[model samples]
Target: MEAPLITADTLVALIPEILALAFIAVVLLTEVFGSRSPNLSSGLAALGALALAGSATVLLAAGFEGSFFGDGYVVDGFALLFKILVGLVAFFSVLAAARWSARTGDTGEYMSLILAVALGASLLVSGRDLFVIFVSLELATIPSYAMVAFDRRRRESSEGGMKYLLTGVVASSVLLYGLVLIYGVTGSANLSEVAAAFTADLSPAALLGLVLFLSGVAFKLSVVPFHFWTPDAYQGAPTNAAAFLSVAPKMATFALLLRVLIEGMPETAQAYTWLFALLAILSMFAGNLFALRQTNLKRMLAYSSVAHSGYILAAFAALTGPALETAVQAVIVYAVAYAVMNLGAFFVVELVGEEGKSFNGLFRTQPALAVSMAVFMAALVGIPPLSGFWGKAWVIFATAQAGAWVVVGAVIINSVLSVPYYFGVIRSMFFEEPAGVGPVKDGSGALRFSIYAMAVFTVLFAFILGPLVLLAQAIGL
Candidate 1:
């Protein structure tokens, strides 16, 4: 086939994503030869990369639509918005992992994987074709499996890594099968073509293909019925890895889902609404209820992440014109907000083990860290005066507007149910006396900054939600 017309406009539009890949290459080369401590090198490279990606993002946003190699790759408002979000998330995650890298003495490889994962996430956000999306998802996932077991000294980490790899493989295969079905039905792998295919026919075979495709999407998003791997993986992975895992993948996956469902399968919405509605309810209830029983902070947040997936799904099920746009904006903003809060919370928890003690006695030893953790926990619970509440409020508003009242009710009820578990961390911190086991040391200056930054954002997210909502609408998403 003649090479699709490549235009300057398209190349400019994709500069952020293209430069992101280039940054990864630079990091890889530096790691290959730079004599500096790998940890320092990795940290600096990761930070520099995110900064470069941010600049690219600004450039792309300043211009307009650009397509590459025919209709294969798209640079648009939707892609730019998600690319920025993923870059920010990856940058923060690298910051969170800095100390962990230093301690493990494996900073170079770990940091390199982080850069690679970020590149993958960027690809996922920008993907316009099924093949590209699947490849990008693998790009993100493979590095994470290694990160999970980055510290070979820990058996739990190894187990977690194994479980993550095995489960991820299964999910990937299932998703691929679904994608193949779409390709068969549509005779095309482009997302837009798949949606057109849905409208062309209403056959059992077509419906099966649609359902199968959605199942894979559901797995990636960690929606109900396919979320069994989440908690174990979260609990077992290194804390920083868990934080990265929790935020970055979800951001890209959701963006991919939005593009595919809304743009690629608009005609299937009416038929698929109920299925999404049911998944939303189950994910919320199951995640929230299970979270209530968890004592491990990482595991609790894992369930909380799962619950948020339900909330997002509920919004999707309830989507209309501007409602879909609003909900998606809410999802992206909330992803950023959650990344900060969750990573900060984990950072503090990691500090609690500073004096060679597990994070069991946080309240008595480190009151300030405890309080910051409380803010994060409260935000996660959707309490008023915090960003989490507004994040959830927009989602609920979108769901209600879509007329998915049942789904809305389920989300509200789940949010209520979620409060106790989220607050359970706070309760452990302030309400109950610390175990008084040992001294609690605080985090490094960088960790402190991360925590404070997240706390400030969690506190201020509601005020910012309005503009983000406007930005979302402007995108025509």
Candidate 2:
């Protein structure tokens, strides 16, 4: 057989991935033989992420669209939107990591691993074939495993990394088995082909495969029953890694889940919808209830993450023909809102301390951080005029439109249940007496920049809802 032609369009479609890989190479090479400066390496990574984001934006504006490698890879509106999101997250993560590495040392390896993970996430969002998706997921996850263990001096780090690794391996195995069954039933690994093969009367084997596939994605999203490793992993990993892991991976996986279900298994939407509804309910109550009792800030945030995943899942469960586009918009908007607020909250945790009590009297000392934390908390509880409020509101609206009242009610109740824990940090910061004699150590400049930038974005996102809605609508199609 003759080799398939690789055209200029194919190369152009791959510029984001190519640029990310080049950045990774530069970071690693600099670590080995160059200045060995953490700041420089992280700066380069951040700049590269900005460049990639700019490229994605330009491509998006130009309405660039194409597929390559027999449709295994795609650069379309959906892919471009997610690529831009992944790039922004990577830029913030690198900025945060620069401060972390300066304190902990090992700057080059740290930045390089982050870039590698970003590359993987970017690839995952653009993947259109089963093989490509699997490889991209592994690429995104493996580096995260290393990052969880990067703080070798801490025993909890090792423990967290081990648990995360074991859980991930099992999830990957289950996911691969599901993919094999899918290929067996459809005789194709291409998502579009699989969609064409799937029928309303799905076979038991195909149904099982679909369930297993969702189970794998559920682990990444940290939904209930598949979220056993989340709190430990978050509490144990370096805070910056936890922040990145909490946002970027979830966004990418959610993107993949949307693609797989909507494109590859639309015929089974009703079955998956019910399954997701059940998971969403379980995750919301379980995560919030567990968080309510937590004293450690990281663990609380980890549980909060699980609950937020439920919010996004609620949107997924509400998917129907009439509500389909709206549901997609809900998920995307929520993902971005969650990324900004959640990352800001984690940055605060990194600045103050990981324990909830450490925030006592923060308003008396770090007034700016205290105020920012309060905004994040309010936004998290779905208070109006904040990005998070709009995110949850959209999900509720979409679910109501789809007649998924159970999901809508669950989301509302979860939002109420979440308030106590979310505000607990605020109370500690503003109302409680100081536990220490002085202010918390001011974070490094990069860390401060990340925190302030995210905080500003969280507040400003509400005003830009119109443009964001349009963007989401564009990508949904």
Candidate 3:
């Protein structure tokens, strides 16, 4: 008899994803057969995320590692870092949604979908095979469709979701084509094998596959020219959903990018780095410039997300050097900072409203909330001693050290360009008079608590900057 393909160690390494699936199953069953307590459902989802993060961290610390299913899946420090990131995003998303979830009721499916996205994100960060990446990417993406349109009662939700799905389909198709071309050229779906087969001089088909595959990844990362879907989706999706989508998918997709570029396609780094540089420059200018015209807070932030993508890519553009690991670590740290500040900002939008005017006189009404928003906005502006500053500082340090001066310039210039609008938010909150009573819309303690926690991190993250770098080195790309 043939030995089992699955070993005991495989199961142990798979614990995080398994836990996500198990929670997903329980969530669905509860929706179908159990009582309809929104708290229970959301609580379970949050708890599951907590467990997933805890498990991933434990595995990372325990030095657990595995490659399973013929190298299609693997677990290592890199994957665990993303798993931990995804879990934190999911958990905070639930906490952000707690008040809204409770008030709206029927959160079973909502929480279930979040868990499903989390599970797929976990899978995506571990994929080492073309087929595995595609499957995991879809699993991570499909649920987001429903999530964007979760407010089926609203027309914008439907339209945004439809546009998202249609455009997403095209991106995915293009991605699939690229994957198929690479598979055909290389005759293997395994990334490591494919990389080993590639040479400095590649076939036309291989080059095309490389470009197309990157385009698809660009769409996921919201790189400019591929980011048209972002503002519409954020404007249309529920605020909480926007928060989750902004962070989770991007982080996972970035992990995939690191795997492909660093581990799977180092031979193609010259071309890839050049492309990333071009895209990074374009994304920075376009995202910042366009954001200047948006009066809606969500749209502005959507554009901000685009700009931040460019900042991270500025660091990523430095992946050409011998010190690739340091570049990769910079990208990861930037992602974490982006997640924290963006989530904090969006959670506030969730609490108040989406209109830029929503923040008018916020300081007059709620001091804590206003102060928190200030920290987040300041961080986004890359002010010193905040998380955003640290994120930008590291990116600048790493990119400059790698001699990617042009990319560093773009990041700095764009940060300056973003000042007017970002600080415009602050001025409105502190300088303007309140339009009405009870400026806060949600009134949920959960939302308040979550927002406060994120703000705390945004401010105190400077203290943890050292650990983040150490953790990146310990886990690695």
Candidate 4:
């Protein structure tokens, strides 16, 4: 009954979270005590994000590894990799938010919420206990609910936020019930302990709990059958909020799924692998087929995101023993590629109007942006010499190695199915006539930086595949 001693390493492990909390404080204080300047609040948030990234880099270089708080938290190569990603996403998101908040003049709450969500996501990837995972997931999600409705002037924003909130509440309830059942059966909330408990035959309650857990996670991933809210939420939310929601939350949820499934329930991998396969096939066909008919760019991208989730889930479905490590690598690489291209695409949509017609004559007016959008589109379609191509190729290869032929076929068919919608945007941008007279206004400096930086990364990611492969292998360890 002795209290466990806290160590300096434990605090160091939490540097990112601590920095996020401190930044949130600074952002909120600036809102109340200072001149209420949007630029200053956003600048502070960006600085905090950079500092966190820098701290993560320093820690990663130091080669620190250990569990803390009775193994409730962990610091490993996997956690470090994701923390770095979360920081990068937060850095760009705040930069984008600065410009967005300047327009809305809601600097304080906006910047704080971004930091709050970032903190939540960072914690989520590092959590090793069920309680920690659940709490971190909520932390990441709740602020996003408000962000979706930040543009109160728009009825679509309110409607989108409401739907997102309601769906999330139900998902959370289902997930929690599953967690309770698991805890009751395993008599532990720690993932390692739960996994050890599964060495024996699983009970009916445990199986039910597992199904419920995955069902809840599917809602977050926005896969088919649980994805009714995605288009409305993305279309109704502010463009930047949609952008952040598209990447950050999905990354965190995937990380949570990986941790829970791989680390917490390895014994049940074979059984659930088929479940993920079924979901993957359904998501791919549903997303791409639905997206083909969409006129609005936001809604199209929403469906496209669902398809991308299916691609990652396909890797999960191929999680047999020999293929498990490769599957992990595919997920990591694809997650990064998807984040880059998807965010870049969304940034383009934010700059151009959200309607497909808005891209007409883009090549004639903003040729550089038009080309950038084209790169993202081509990458999305899994064309060669782009990051997205490698992502999809690896996943399909991994699936093939696992002998999940059906998932592989679904992936190939879905990629072909996706070409029309992705190319439709390109055709509009390059081949169509202008709807207006002059060039479309390029957005703020931050927005431009985000767009171009992502574009360059997408194109150049092929060159860095070696390092990415190494990182992915490290995560599998």
Candidate 5:
């Protein structure tokens, strides 16, 4: 056969993925030379993830656009944007995991799995075919289940992993069935072909399939009604794992939702408006309201993350031209801000817990972490002068523009209701005195830098919204 077509862009597009895979290999091999030193493996892995991210940055700046593998792989502004975010999320997640991995004695495996997760996330965002998307998504999730169960000594960890496994299998089956239906109807799984199949004459079977596929994606995003697993999983998982889980998958899912909804279900918009709307309202109300009573800090953040997913759904529902761009912008900005705050919160918890005991007396012992935790909590609450405030403002504004009056109201009410619960965490840290002496350790150098960097990013991005806005626009919304 003649040589397949080759392009400079395709070569560049593979850069990050290749680097990530190589790093995973090298880290595994490095462990052989120093089997007792998991730290060496973890440090190598962190540097490799950074290198992967840097490669992605370089490729993104070089500006490659279009699809590969007969339209199975895509490289566009939107894909690049999400890939970059995934890279950053992985990079920070590595930073967050360093000390935790060292403490847990699974540094090598943890770092390797995290890299694998990043690879899956990158593929999920850039996949142009339904089959490719499905395969890529599983790659992302399977590793997560193992990562959650890494601490086999902890019963909660096992339970959490089992719960995730059960939910994940069911969700994957539903999504696959949905894809089968669409393939039967359209005779193809390519997104563009599916989009072309949308018509005023679509059968009910097609609609059902579309909805099932969406339901699967909804579960991945932890939208309400489908979000029952989030709090439990977050609570049971290790703090570092929870922090990683909170942002990475959601960002990829957001990009995937944008692609599937805009590309697959165009014909059934009217039929599905109610579905999206329900998810949005429930995620917002359920996430925020249920979070109000949680005493465990990670669980509270889990629910809060759920609530934020709802807001992003609302933005997704309002998908038209500038309106869609604004909504997506809200999600990107919020994702960035949420990543910062959530990581910062986990950093504080780990900082407090570092004394080889559970965290206690957070305020009295680690005042720096306590104050940093307060700032992060406030950001999650969408308070002003914080990036999260702008994130919500943009989403609500976009919803109003779309004439989604009920959802707009629901968004407003949810924000109002979320305040007390978020503040409750802050209040516990700053106002309530420690009931007793707990873990009394200061943060390590890596942990301290993670906290400081995230805190600064959250506050700094709150002020510079222009670049993110431009990025959303450039991503074709």
Candidate 6:
């Protein structure tokens, strides 16, 4: 018998998406009837994201694990954990945008857009079928383009948005074509069926489809060659949007990549490890090299993000070895580590002006803020005890344990390469001098609170490492 499209199981699996949709409606209606207020909209939207996160947590605690929609969507430890993370990033995005959107005069629109991206990300992590993956990715991606261009006051915002949009369209089309090709080869859209269909060899069409799909995901991860848009977009978009774009969507996309490769294409996993290794190396080199030369805060951090993609990719290179589970755990840990530290870093940029000189001698005026920023930078550099260090440490340990020393060396070299630039931010903050003839205010209260919160999390992440490992273990495919 054919299954019904909607089921009690489907409803249980989709509590986050349902709540996100309902909150979007409420946010819009309130915006239409009530006075225009950035703080109000930001609060409502962040509350919605938190509400969705709460729902996911409750579901996870209730042991809500299942394959719904004919295995197109999954509710498991893996997806549940990421849902909570994405929600947090969603909250941060709204928190940061409150002040940024005050001048834009449309908090309601951008806030809703942020929630939409959150909804998409929540769904993308659970996506197991090609159709669900494509649809969810687009849902997450389309809103990002609008958010990037939302700051019409700046010509660079428009330019960045257009560049991002144009490139995204091409990537989407390519990805869709690949999905269609895969569907044709497998004669099914479900990942289990596709996995069953793979054999000892791939036809030319299947090979081409694999390449296309990876290329599309590479665009999202800001992998080298396709990463040109990253720095420009971050530099051009509002810092709040860049903050959201950098971490949340990336976590979700990495989840999607894992689902596709491990679940949908397991037969080819060993064969693809080499490709991942090569890409990881290239991304590390290109990202760090370009980042070293960038003087702009957003652009440099943007490059750092690209380099980070490489660090995470190193885990994927170890997927075929006996350390497979370790590799997976490393990626999971790296995602959280990157999230807290990177979001803290970008939010710091939101407070300080974008130029490197704006941070010169920040320690002289705002010691606390400068110190908070230093933690984030040191973490990004993979310095000891900080979140970034833990993330890269696991990546290296996993690769080395798997005997993938080339990947290990690449990671080590890149970590060393990154130290100078990441430390550059700290140097400007402490050693140099602040710009112009005005007292630097410490930015909005909400923004400052986020910086402080993320800073603490980055510092204290080591305490949670054990729990993170257990969580990763529980995330059995």
Best candidate, lDDT-wise? 6
Where does model 4 exceed 4 Å of error?
Answer: 1-3, 199-201, 437-443
Q: For every model in order, what is the number of clashing pairs?
A: 1, 0, 0, 0, 0, 2
For candidate 4, write residues 1-477 as lDDT tens digits. 765668787888888789889999998998899988888898999988887777877787788788888888888888888888888888888877677678788888988888888888888988889889889999999999999989977899999999999999999999989988888989999999999866436789998888788888899899878999999999998888888889988897898888888888886876668889999999999999999999999999999999999999999987787888888889888999999999899988887879888899899988888999999999999999898999998998889999999999999999999999999999999899989853345447888788899999999989777898987786564
Query: Residues 162-181, candidate 1, lDDT per residue (tens digit)?
Result: 98889878878888888888
What's the residue-level lDDT of 159 in candidate 1? 92
Q: Give one digit per residue, the lDDT tens place, for model 3 in 1-477.
A: 865789898899899989989998897788789998887888898998998999998998898887999888989888998999999999999888777766656588888888889999999999999999999999999999988988866798878888888899899989989999999998999998889756668899998998789889899888988999999998899889999999998999988988988777886874567678889899989999999999999999999999999888887777876658778888888899989999999999999889988799999888889999999999999998888998888888888887888888888888899999999999999999888773545447778888999999899897777888898888776
Q: In angstroms, how far off is 435's CA in candidate 4? A: 1.4
Q: Candidate 3: what lDDT?
A: 0.88
- Cα lDDT for residue 205, model 3? 97
Quote the lDDT for 280 in model 5: 93
Model 4 lDDT, residue 379, Cα = 96
- Tens-digit lDDT track for model 2 on 117-144? 8888888988889989999999999999
Residue 124 accuracy (lDDT) in model 4? 90
For model 4 the TM-score comes to: 0.97
Model 5, which residues run further than 4 Å from truth?
Answer: 1-8, 353-361, 436-443
Location of the lowest summed lDDT over 10 successive residues in candidate 4? 437-446
Of candidate 3, the 10-residue stretch with the lowest lDDT total is 437-446
Q: Write down the TM-score for model 2.
A: 0.98
Write candidate 5's Cα lDDT for 1-477 as tens digits.
753666776777777888888998887776656674766877778777787778877766877677888788887878877777887778877877887778777688788989988888988988878899999999889899988777767798889888988998899899889988988888898988987776646788887788788889988899878898888788778778888877887889888978877766555653455667788998999898888877777777788889988987887767754466566677677677777777787777656642212334467866777778788878878888886787778888887877778988998888789889767666666666676664544336776788888888877875567887786777673
Clash pairs for candidate 5: none
The candidate 6 region of ten consecutive residues with least summed lDDT is: 434-443
Instruction: For each candidate in the order shown, give its overall lDDT on alpha carbons.
Output: 0.74, 0.88, 0.88, 0.88, 0.78, 0.89
lDDT accuracy of residue 147 in candidate 2:
94
TM-score of 1: 0.93
